[model samples]
Target chain A: MEVAVSIITGLMILGALYAIHAKDLLSSVIACGIVGYSLVICFLLLKAPDLAIVQIVVDTITLIIMVAVVLDSSREELFLKPDTQGYVTTLTGVFLLAIFLYFFVISVQSLDILGKGSLRMAEQYINGAAQKTGSANLVTGVVFDFRGYDTMGEAVVLVTAVLGVLTILRIKGKK
Target chain B: MKGMTLIVKKTTQLMAGIVFMYGIYVIVHGHLTPGGGFAGGVIIAGSLILVTLAFGSDFLKLVKEEAGTTLIESFATLMFILIAVSGFFFGTRIFFNNFLPKGVVGHLISAGVLPLYNIFVGTEVAASIFIIFLSLIIFKEESAQ
Candidate 1:
């Protein structure tokens, strides 16, 4: 299962690379959606159902928004322009990719802090959560109590984005 | 061509309403099932997209300008934060620290503030998503036409 998951993830990463280089806007959008869908699958296989659910939902919304943005853009060189930015952008992209690949490989081999925390807390939460929070769902306990602040921050970030859009886009008299 | 599209539009409107109700069901029962804020939110957003497809851009304009989806979105966000902050006043050492009663495990009133937060998230997500699409459509139509 792990090997199959790895293969799928590799394919997804390659798809993302292709998305960057794809000449057509529609193809790029499709590739982006493929990447998001594959990531959800990858998250599921990693045994984080909550993460998987959140990823898939957020991803679908993001994909739709991005496609809409692309469609709305009037720029003729939407995807046809090759990178003309001297060596700066190319070098930056290569450096970032390499660093991300290295970290990704390292993360796969070891238990990161989050994984450790989840493993350590999973049993305790499962055993006592019902009595403490009166909730059957362990994921809910973790989200609403253990790391509720983080989730709240995420919601705030989302709201900020919405507010920014409204302020910039609202016509003068049209409330 | 335009006349043939009206039938398609009406059909999609009906479908959108059905889908929207399903999303509401998923959201309201989220605590007991696999669906929660994220899943239910997306489902609702999908339904809104259907409305766009069926009813034409005029419907979108009406919803955007008159429905106050943006205000709902903002209020939902504020309420979510306020609920989280409610924990701080209890001196529980951690925010959202199960300050209220959790109630019965499977009851509708269970999970302390979780369900409340979920509802807020669902509303924000649904409204934001609809607004996102509406803005894009408006931009495209204005620019292209």
Candidate 2:
């Protein structure tokens, strides 16, 4: 299991790097998609089916929208050659990546990443949740029932985001 | 845009419907299933996206009802807010209360207000995403013109 996660994480990092450096905008978007779909696999392997499902669908839609936008405007991404400053920045990025990876390795070795966390706050939800919410899916129960106000706010945020996009992009509006 | 070739078009026609059905399935069975409103709604939007991509801007023009999509989105949101607020006036008079009966867990009709929330939220999300996609197409056309 640890080996599988390490391999997937490596692939995800490679995808991110490729997305940054890809000469074609479309290929960059696809590489971004590889990162997302790989995270979905990571979620599933961690036994979070609900998160995996959400991640998969959202990733596909995002890919579609990005592809459409890229196809409409430009295909080839402009490439810029790096100078001394750019090289320094790249070196710093590599340094940060190594530190993060070291921390991640240490964290993954703990039992929490394997789904046996301390459950300080979640203890209330996991115990007698089915009876309390009367829903087979505890995540949905928490999302739409216990934390319903938060969910409603999220929905409203989505609506507002769409409204903003439409307002900016509308070809015509009311007179 | 004239869209892809006939093979792509035909394949999309056959597959889009099934994908849409699967999205609805996820939304309807939200309480009992792994996925709920937002995820399922994206799948539904994806099916429409497939159709639009396969058929091109001509198809979108044929369905010149972006206003109608906005109306549906507004109505769904209104309904969602109304449902949430209705609890304030119901049995317990508490805001966001589960005023309805919660049947056995894992049942189709269980989870008093979860399914309703899911359906309304699903509709809102699907409309919102489709509208965004539709407007992007129109924006591209307008800018080009």
Candidate 3:
């Protein structure tokens, strides 16, 4: 299972690279969807169902939005061409991936990224949450409690994105 | 567009509605399940996009952008702030701490301000994402033309 999962991840990384180099924006968006789905599977295999669901849902929305944006902005070109420096980019990417995988392998051996309290002041929520707030999901408890302010800031970011889109698209006396 | 035929569109449209309802279930039962505000909320927005793709902007007209989107956005924000501020009265430093009342762990009324915050987050995320998609779809179509 691990080998299969790793192979799938490798394919996904290749797809992502190809998408970045592909001249077609729509195809790139499709590749992004593939990457997103693969990541969802990876998260599921890692025993993080919550993160998996979030990734799938958020990625679906983002993919659709991006495709729509690109479709609006760009016309279909007659020919498709890969980047001229694709070999260089691929080598650089592979180098980075190897470095990342090395660090990830070592860290997974020694540390727990999934372990709670990875962030500063995270222990405050992990330790004090259930007793004080009585929430079941530790992540939910941390997000809405210890890091409530941060989540609020995230919400503001979403709101601001909406506002920005509206401002950019607004027309005089249209509404 | 190439692979998505007419039958696929019709089927996906129905699936979107199901997904939307499922998202609401996840949001409401967030405390009990693995899902919560953010996950469920985005699922709801995903369903909206499906509907948009299948039926186009006319279906969205039923919601009326101002009342459905903007109003929900503002109201959700207000509720969140109120819950946070009420924590101050109980002497907690930040939001939703003291203001929330305690109940059974698995019960609907439980989780103090946690569940309430989930609801607010669910609404805020759902409305904002839907609004963003709507504006983009509308504007992009115009620009393309």
Q: Tens-digit lDDT track for model 2 on A1-175?
A: 7788889999999999999989989999999999999999899888889899889988988997898789777898777789999999999999999999999898877656555565766888888888887789999999987898898898899899998997887666545
Interface RMSD values for all candidates: 2.7, 1.3, 1.9
Clashes of each: 0, 0, 0
Candidate achieving the largest lDDT: 2
lDDT tens per residue, model 1, B1-145 = 0122777877886687887887887677667666677667778988877666566665446444425877888888889888877778875766676677778888877888788877888888888777776765555455455
Q: Which pairs of residues collide in candidate 1? A: none
**Fraction of true contacts reproduced, model 1?**
0.43
> TM-score: which is higher, 1 or 3?
1
lDDT of 1 by residue, A53-166 (tens): 667867876776677567766423454344567578888899999999999998877765433455655677677876777666666666666778787877788777866775
Model 1 misplaced stretches (Cα beyond 4 Å): A72-85, A88-126, A170-175, B1-4, B63-67, B85-97, B139-145
**How well does each candidate superpose onto the true structure, as a TM-score?**
0.80, 0.88, 0.78
RMSD of each: 3.9, 2.8, 4.7
Q: Which stretches of candidate 2 lie over 4 Å from their true place?
A: A81-114, A171-175
Inter-residue clash pairs, candidate 2 = none
Model 2 docking category: medium
Worst 10 residues of 2 chain A by lDDT: A109-118
Write candidate 2's Cα lDDT for B23-138 as tens digits. Answer: 99999999998999988988898898888889898756723756888899999999999999998998987767888889998899998988999999999999888988888877
Cα error of candidate 2 at position B137, Å:
0.4
Off by over 4 Å in 3: A1-5, A69-128, A171-175, B1-17, B58-63, B91-93, B141-145
Give the lDDT of residue A139 in candidate 3.
Answer: 72
